[model samples]
Target: MTSPAVPRQPLLDDAIIALHAPTQAWSGRDGDIGDAAIDGIYHGDIRHIRSVRIRVADSSIETISRSIIDAATVEFGSVLRGLDDDGADPKVRLIRHRALSAGVMTEHLGLHSHRDVPLSVAVTVEVAPEFAPMQDVKAGLAATEPWHAEAIAASDGTPGRIEVRSSDGHRSFVVEAAGAAATVADTIVLRWDIELDPRSVVEIGWSATLTDDTLVVAAAANSEIAVPSTDDPRLARWVEQATRDLAALRLVLPDHPEDAFYAAGAPWFFTLFGRDSLWAARLALATDPGIAASTLRVLARLQGTKTDPATAEQPGKILHELRSAPLSLPNEGVHLPPLYYGTVDATPLWVCLLADARDAGMPEAEVRELVPALRAALTWITDFGSGTGSGFLDYVDETGHGLANQGWKDSGDSIQWRDGRLAEGPIALCEVQAYAYEAAVRGAQLLDDLGEGGGDELREWAAVLRDRFRDAFWVTTPEGRYPAIALDAHGAAVDSLTSNIGHLIGTGILDANEERACADLLLGASMSSGFGIRTLSLGAAGFWPLSYHGGSVWAHDTAVAVHGMLRSGLLAEAREVAGQLVDAAEGFAYRMPELHSGDSHDAVPFPTPYPASCRPQAWSAAAAIVCAEAYAAAP
Candidate 1:
């Protein structure tokens, strides 16, 4: 019998990422691009440059050091032993500095010589471009056919330029280099022959500008979140590092340039995502409510206005994701339209963020402007959220090609029974119910504040949801009583002691005692990995440290629980989890990834990296701000 083919996915554990909104560059720690699967200069969902290398003829450069200066800048230092004068100290060095912007990537190469005599060398920059779509690259598919750039004659005083175009001419880019001769062969080459005087440095640079008309996101006008002052250096460093990453992730819709939201993450999800952007904005709300306000506006502009099964769009629904083209994963049986609306929680979360943003100092006028969208989203919550007649907010992928499980844990195996069985859909997740109840109550208060009237009805609706959730979602195991992860198709609780219960805290769906019960369960041995809360308890049959949502630790997930604990006045519990997040942040060098293994801290000195996790993920980076705020609220 033939074995089933293993899915091909790229590993990014060692890849260094630099990004500024729609443009990102992935390279090795030594700053060389194109050898690894994910190494490339990508602009607006297209890989513009596949490979980049710096070569010195007759001498080998040994990379000795690498430093990430900021979210969009990296520096590498290399020594040339063959060219160096014979001495204990190296006399010749090469420095490479790289930076990224909206659609441009710039690199400056500096060669320095400390020898008493002058040194002459030939330096060549080899570059190759392959116009591969983001999804194609992500799936580990073979690279699209390679394309060569055409040399554009240098005009007076300006740098020589070369233009690269895709076969379809839909995407293109230009390369410009000053004081260098350009040639096109097997690879595009920019050559410089220079002589460095004693104790002097010679520098040359080249820039690439990628152009794609189909892009929906652009670099924000300003991307700054005020870092909180803290006496604890660890908290300060985490916030500082996270602020830079969050700034680079900020993006604005081209049509709504004034409204800025965060792109989900790099190498894959570098575009507006409803759930991710909403949660990121919500998590960082204490530091900057303006971003939340703007993010609400961005998503509101794209709010669903009609029902479309193919894209999972329904009237007033929030979108799941936005991409330049349809994302199709044949192996996974997943196909998503550019503006799919498959999420179960983003709509309610949107309302929750809107109310929270207002409380966090968003301008009254701005909140007022979103009232219509708010009302429509509430309508969606009532009309379509429970369309499956599940008596709770639920999601089912009717297209069979969309996400099977539609909560934050969208993996197919995410909604599972405690005994390792995958739950059948239409799944009503416990956390979605909490988010919906909170949104209804908050939306009611906002409508009353705006004199729109409907506060009482909304409150009544929230009460019903809370009661129903209390009665139907709770389950008991040898581990004790807590809410189940979700309800399966037969109205039976899929009893999995998972992090979904963590989100129920402070949502008003659970009472004080219930919230405390959840806090205790989360801190217990099976669920608390000492690094952060695990998605699924270690004792669960389906638990695996590296499983995407089965038993992994997502920084954002822990932060959400921490935020809820703080809101519910569970200060001690909040601090405990927040500190664990701080430890995890330090483990990842203060730039958290999308998710990490749920390995016990006692077993591993540090949290293990989930090999394919995307670093600088928007929500994960924003988690730092939540942790800092939790620590700061130490009364």
Candidate 2:
């Protein structure tokens, strides 16, 4: 886990609020809303569950236009080279978006990249008849009115019209007051700016029925009623906050403005990155468990199901990431990546997650029915993943389009030689081996319990993994300390004594002694930070708060480690860490993003937030669930 110093913001009150505070005044500034803002608050304990739902769905034409007002003007200037002619991955492209009520003109800033525009960037507006112009908003909404307008709010005599941008630059809309109680069923139009050339407008029309709990606030946006949404009312605040925080992660990839992003820096990352999707699914499982189930099914169903040396894909392996880009460079002779499958961790981790879904309350029996697919993934790991079967795992991208290290420290030089020189792949890292061991053990459990065939074989395979892993990975020093990070194919230890050591939780392969040793290392003074735990300990040579993977304090990773500690019966320790994390979250406005930095314990009161890591990341957002598990198990 990486911990960056958190920016000082008004933290959520520490006092526990009753579940039914209807007027739980939403805190925090919609500071950025002058452009388009979203605000989500954590409603702890929604029906006594570890889940949260955000209340930031804007569906008012006035609100939408007001959002657009923040935007001066937006230009869609696209360039497409004919495919295979001279480096062109040319495809269709079309772009249409709403303009804000009154601020800057978006025309100055052109679309940046090839990433698709997202749904979050749209101005959320209500299309009710009263809100909309005299024209029937419902009929127009149902039968494709494409345009409407309304003048309301005895206050702001200025009327608001919902404009739907056509691919050809035509704008049509129905005017309506922002946030008028939905007296009639309405549809919200989200403009899809097709960045890929030849992009045709396959109009996406969607209408949602509003329930009583669904508040239509003109001041804010539409958010689902807390209790009924996620089962536990306590979780509503967090869920709402997580949903609103999703906007914080939105970025306008250079060639791709006018669309919401879910990328690295703020004002951009709104596109659906595969990793982000997986994380969102995990957290959504708590609130919108349906999303979690569907995300898994979707990813698994669309998983790279072929094993070809050229693509580095194994049958039934879930992909690391995917993108729909026509302007992307050709992969055969270039470093360009339309969609890269370089991550070695996603596969085994996916299996474990599927298995975990059941434990978190999904039906294991049902997940087990996908036996053949699971077996295919297991094969990919032991066979192709091993590359050179030393019982350890290593990934040298066969296609070279994928990542270099392939694990979380996926950046180049991520995996290193003992002397701090980068290690060459087929490099086997300890965590990957742990993931393999955990997945196999859990997979076998799912199989055996479900009366699946080869239960014996499954157990046997897991046993072999356990035997080899303990033998090959552990090294005892004179002071009774073994190396932390594992070695690459070269047999040299890539020892960087840090919290990557904590990733071994749930492997079930660590014996009591090894578990105890690892736990000691984790809770030790050097490894643990004031703000949760650091990715790499503070003293390691490679340690840096901002370093992508090596040193930042990631919430999800630490949550996993805390769970690992709880698993080993260190209840008090687990509770402390979990509490600290919740406390740390308060500093970051109570919503955990990918990570923060822990530069110094004394550094002015809080962990400095990583400038713009993906906020509301799935695992980070879902850390509360993990924390809840540890909390429930704590002594």
The alpha-carbon RMSD values of the candidates against the true structure, listed in the order shown, are: 1.6, 17.8
In candidate 2, what are the lDDT values of residues 391-453, reduced to their tens digit?
Answer: 666778765555666676666755543235666667777887778888777777777777766
Q: Each candidate's lDDT (Cα)?
A: 0.90, 0.48
Q: Which of the numbered candidates is closest to the native, going by highest lDDT?
A: 1
Please give each candidate's TM-score. 0.98, 0.61
Clashes of each: 0, 116
lDDT of 2 at 237: 47
Tens-digit per-residue lDDT, 42-146, candidate 1: 998888889999899878989999989999999999998889766889889999999998899999999988888988889999888888887778778847665
In angstroms, give how far residue 347 of model 1 lies from its true place.
Answer: 0.5
> What TM-score number comes out for model 1?
0.98
Given candidate 1, what's the lDDT at residue 350?
98
Off by over 4 Å in 2: 1-240, 243-289, 309-311, 326-339, 417-419, 476-483
